[model samples]
Target: MKYDVAVIGAGPAGAMASKYAALNGAKTLLIEEHASIGSPVQCTGLISKAALTECEISEGSFVLAKMKGAFVYSPGGEELTIRGKDVKAYVIDRKLFDRELVGRSIDTGADLMLKTRFMGLHHGRISVLSSGERKDIHADIVIGADGIMGSVGRAAGLPRCKKFLSGIQFEAPYDACDAQFVEIFTGNKFAPGFFAWAVPFGRMARIGLAKNAGDRPALHYLEELIKHPVLASRYRGSRTEHVVGGIPLGAPERTVKDNVMLVGDAAGQVKPTSGGGVYMGAVCAKIAGEVAARAARKEMDIKEYEKKWRSAVGRELALGMIIHKSLGKLSDENLNEFISFLNRPGMSECITEYGDMDHPSVLLKEMLKGADKMRLVRLLGVAFKTLF
Candidate 1:
């Protein structure tokens, strides 16, 4: 089959790209290797309210719970509460959510191809294995929304993300302090270079953590997490579902090469601080789709996708990387001090008003404006120098 644009991967990013491509008059094809979408779920399913708006979807059957705040625990077990006046995020069922997105793409005139595995891209020809048979589909432009492994990008000889955090999680029955608030745990002993979390929905919680601990598998940390006093107190000792995956950070120097463009995880579009890619991926996918459609018609260069997407979210991602690196470097004692500083009088109010899951730089910038700025600077180490 031949199409104007062929988008590989049917995740949120691929679905959005195909939808925009079709809406822009391109004959778009959305390809997925799996027989279905959203299978083998790798995400925590926690997404911000702004993510839904970015994806252009209303609250649907996929939303399982609404979150209004978070309870952060320092290495010393100190609690810092950040309460939002309104719903800030949602816990969703990724299967239903992904299907909804792909359905939108189909409705927008994009063709869906299931059980089609992208073999490679060669000489302007798209190759795939479908129904145990090799086939070739022609397309003027290719958009890769594949995951962190970036199969499509690799085939096109693109550089991969600079770093990857090993992540593991399980869904289990848990007694949460408050269903409307997620719980965050921080310390080198547990997560090492990253953090752990318990995102609750109803009586169940997705408990997991991502860490930069080299050589030691994430499962090692997962075992430590469940034994923590906070988690052990609430965990029912039985898990219903488990997820293990890698979260990529640090986008490569280039995301576009020739007629090919990369978006979403393939392009390292995830937020470094949160390991959340949906919001940023959706933002970039729209640009990739539009640019692919135009490039197919010779109205634009494929490079425009790179420029447009970066202009939109590059600075935010860069700043998030700074914060992630800064936090990852802190010793347990320093972390305790940092969290303590945030727990100071009037500090909770400042955090509650400025804390944003999507754009952490805003909160950091605001913190620098406060009188205790020097304290925070000392806590962040040398990374603070590069943040601004």
Candidate 2:
């Protein structure tokens, strides 16, 4: 089949990219390797409200729970509650969510092809094995919305994301203090570089962790996480539907090469602090699609895709990397001190007023307003130095 744009992958990123491309008047085709749109769910499904807006979909069957806040557990086991006055995020069923996104894309005039596996690129075209039959398609612009194992990226010889974290998770019946408050576990014992999370959905929660670059695997961390004093109390005596995956961080210097552009996990647009990609991926994918469509018309260079997307989110991603590195370097004692500082009389209120999942730097600036306090000064000095 021939098209102006071919988006390889039917995940949220690819769906949005194809939808935007079609909306911009490009004849777009979205291909999914899986028989179904969403299957073998790999995500924990905690998405910010802004993320939902970016995806342009209202609450649907995919939304399992809405969360208002998070209960953060410091290394010393001291709990601090970061509350939002309104709904902060949602816990979703990724399988249903992916289907919804693809449906919307199809509605926008993007053709859909299932059971299509992208093989590689040929001379100015793409090779795919569709439904057990091999074929070649010529396209003005190709988008690699595929996941971490993106064949399009390989075909284009794009560099990989800087690093990857091993992740493992399982759904289980949970006993939580508040249904709206997700639980965060932070300590070297549980996750050395990153943190563990229990995102609640009614009486059930998705418990998972992503391990930093280390010898230990993600499952090893999951094994240790379940035994945590907090998780051990809530987890029912059962295990089912476990997911193993990799979380990518720090995008490669280039996400666009020649006539191809990368979006979502394929581009490593995930936030290091949260290990979430849907929000940032959607933000970048729109630009990728628009650029791809415009480039197909010979109205813009494909490199415009690179420049525009980076100008939009490059700073935030860079800041997130700094925060991730700072937190990963902290000792148990340092974490205790940091949490203790936040537990002070006036601190939580400040966080509540300015905190945002999609923009932590906003909260950081607010926190720095009270930098007269030496502890806050020391911490901000270290983190702010990285940003500059």
Residue 103, candidate 2: C-alpha displacement in angstroms: 0.6
Residue-level lDDT of model 2, residues 267-288, one tens digit each, is 9999888899999999999999
lDDT by residue for model 1 over 268-290, one digit each (tens)?
Answer: 99999989999999999999999
Worst 10 residues of 1 by lDDT: 379-388
Best-performing candidate as measured by TM-score:
1
Evaluated against the true structure, the overall lDDT of model 1 is 0.92
TM-score of 2: 0.97
Residue 137: error of model 1 in Å?
Answer: 0.1
TM per candidate comes to: 0.98, 0.97
